[model samples]
Target: MSKGRILIRNGHVIDTEPQPVAHAHTDVLIEGGKITAVGRNLRSKGAMVIDATDRIVLPGFVDTHRHVWHSALRSAAIDIDLGAYFRLLGQVGPKFRPQDVRIATLAGALECLDAGITTQLDFAHIAYSPELANAAVDALKEAGLRAVFAYGTPVNVTAGGKLADVRRIRERLADDNALVTMAYAPLGPLSTPMETVARDWRIADELDLPLTIHLASSPNNEQPIFALREAGLLREKTLYVHANGIGDDELKLIADSGATASATPGDEAGRLRRAGITTGTGIDTVAFAPGDMFSTMRAAHLAGQIAEDPQLTAKDVLRMATLDGAAAMGLADRTGSLRPGKQADVILLRLDDLNMLTAERDPIGAVVTEAQPHNVDTVLVAGKVVKAGGRLVHADLRRTARALRATAAAISGR
Candidate 1:
């Protein structure tokens, strides 16, 4: 049998444990993709040693909600309101062919990996054809990253065209279980018909796969929830993307159904800023952010405290972004904590960074309030070093960025 071991030495391990931070200087042992031990002075004879001195080791980030196809269009929709955003999705999203989707998805996934995100739930809604879906999935696999390709159906342009041959794709991916999982992403109520939504839910239920849908964005739009109820498809297996506009009845339904919510508080705050609205409307869903997990956690914490109770702590925010996100993606049992026997999806943050240093009194608060992507010094996924010393190790990012730019230009007719 093939054997390998990696020893990460002298790092401050922060595994989302409830106790008051122990083992300031310690080592972690990884053997065959799982963490075997975490403590001081680990036996490392014949194992590859990684110096982790002066670093803070924690579980790798799990991005619960992200549109990887929009990587090339980062901040491109900043000026557009919600309606214009939808217009762009309707008009320009379908213009992307399979190649475009491949380049964008690969680039986006690589970006997340380089920035310490180990698991990403990519809401790929640009499935104009089966070829497009296949290409998107291929891109994720090629990146050698852990990901969930939330395969979304095409919009109304193609009447009765299925997104992709789900059976064929499943068969192709069934054996290769290293880092990819597929899920159904039925475009929320606004873009997809209710009957079609029910059909998608049925397919997911039959396959025992998770279902993801966007809901509760605008306070004026209750149609998504209403449509789900009408179709009798709202259940525990469903993952509601956003609950920004969900009412008390909707929250109760979500809580009772045992379904999960993945909220992007930073994006919601950005949207609210752009539209000149209050940020409190979308506070109920599971909060998350792609580029900046700290901002998301802080925003969610403040929102929760302001709207509900003022005594909420920083741990609550951390749990929402870390553990809650993992649960929402059905990956809590495997990740979301620094437990032995689990995949070593982990990261090390440099606490000496300026933003992280000031709030030293509360390390969790410091991470939630001050730390940013730059503070992440190392990232590991499944016992492999993907990023170290703040740089990517697996793929050439400059090439990917150039390719993505060219593809975006072609699709946008620029």
Candidate 2:
């Protein structure tokens, strides 16, 4: 399919763009990979018509940060904290061959698509060699998911040693309009020298790529952003992941510098959002949490509700999973909403599903609070139907499952 026309008719449409709004019994028309119209009874001749009755039509979710290379190790470190998780990575990270990395990355991207995530920023830090880096990029391109492949230093490896490989991968993925783009993922001042961080930032700037970093996840790292600010490296096109445990002043600085923040489950995403920052939701690692945005949204909402302010509502988290997430990834102009001019990254959820049958009164709340990946009935990326009738349209699941199992066994030495 070469970005053909699509007409999704008569559904409950929800979108967060310009502003969050919902429309009932509306139609959305997509042509040449872009949404051309969104209204009642829209007509598009020769378009592939999809009946969306009893479905919730919305822009597909955007995951701002995910270590996609960890897919084969799902639940391996489920009970560990951040420190132990890194230690686990040090143990298993070196065991993965380039083929294994490709399998894990492809599996992870497919998982994202199955859960209605049309776009993701893959915080891929398993690129231990040039072969491994190329393999990971190959996997993303093969999976056909829109992604920002944020290349980074491997765990248990020397930080900033892979800058040249980052450039190489950037050169390979130079087409920004393609599904797979490139970014730089650096171990910020917390785990690397300021000099190394500067080098990483300069390489990223030279490549004209975005920079994403793990910052303020621990108390010792809470001040790394300030250091970046002092070094004059803090700027837009940067995503501060795990802005957890940071103070209001730091949040203000991030907001002022036009930088965005992303938080996994149980982080201060709500705080960042409240401080006028563009806070996106991240699955972070599937090693400990569900990969789907529905679970991530619920976790984020709970994190906010338990906070003193309790101002993060269900709709707010939905935005974090959608438009805000795209903004965090610096691709809001192309995706993140059902806006007429945006790319057609959309999904349909079966509102009549058992879990959502009676939740029509607050559809957005239902999506944020009650929906699950199983409720996703159809998905489209760039006007191409990748999923329909509650199943992936082009995936070879049996083959993928076999490869994943083999990769896991090989990695675990089982």
Best by lDDT: 2
Model 1, global lDDT: 0.69
TM-scores, each model vs. reference: 0.86, 0.97
lDDT of 2 by residue, 1-414 (tens): 456989999999998977677889999999999999999999968998999899999999999989998899999987778789889998898888999999999999999999999999999989889999888999998887899999988768888777778878888999988889988988877787788889888888899998898876354455877888889987998998887567788889999999998888575876887788898889988888899999999988887888888468887888989999999898999899998999999999998889999776777898999999999999999888888899997889889999999999998893
Off by over 4 Å in 2: 217-222
Q: Write the per-residue lDDT of candidate 1 for residues 269-326, one digit (tens) a residue.
A: 3332223221111122111124556656677667655652233356655655556567
Give me the candidate number with maximum TM-score: 2
Candidates' C-alpha lDDT: 0.69, 0.88
Q: What shift in Å separates residue 351 of candidate 2 from its native position after superposition?
A: 1.5
| Consecutive 10-residue window with the lowest summed lDDT within model 1 | 278-287
Worst 10 residues of 2 by lDDT: 216-225
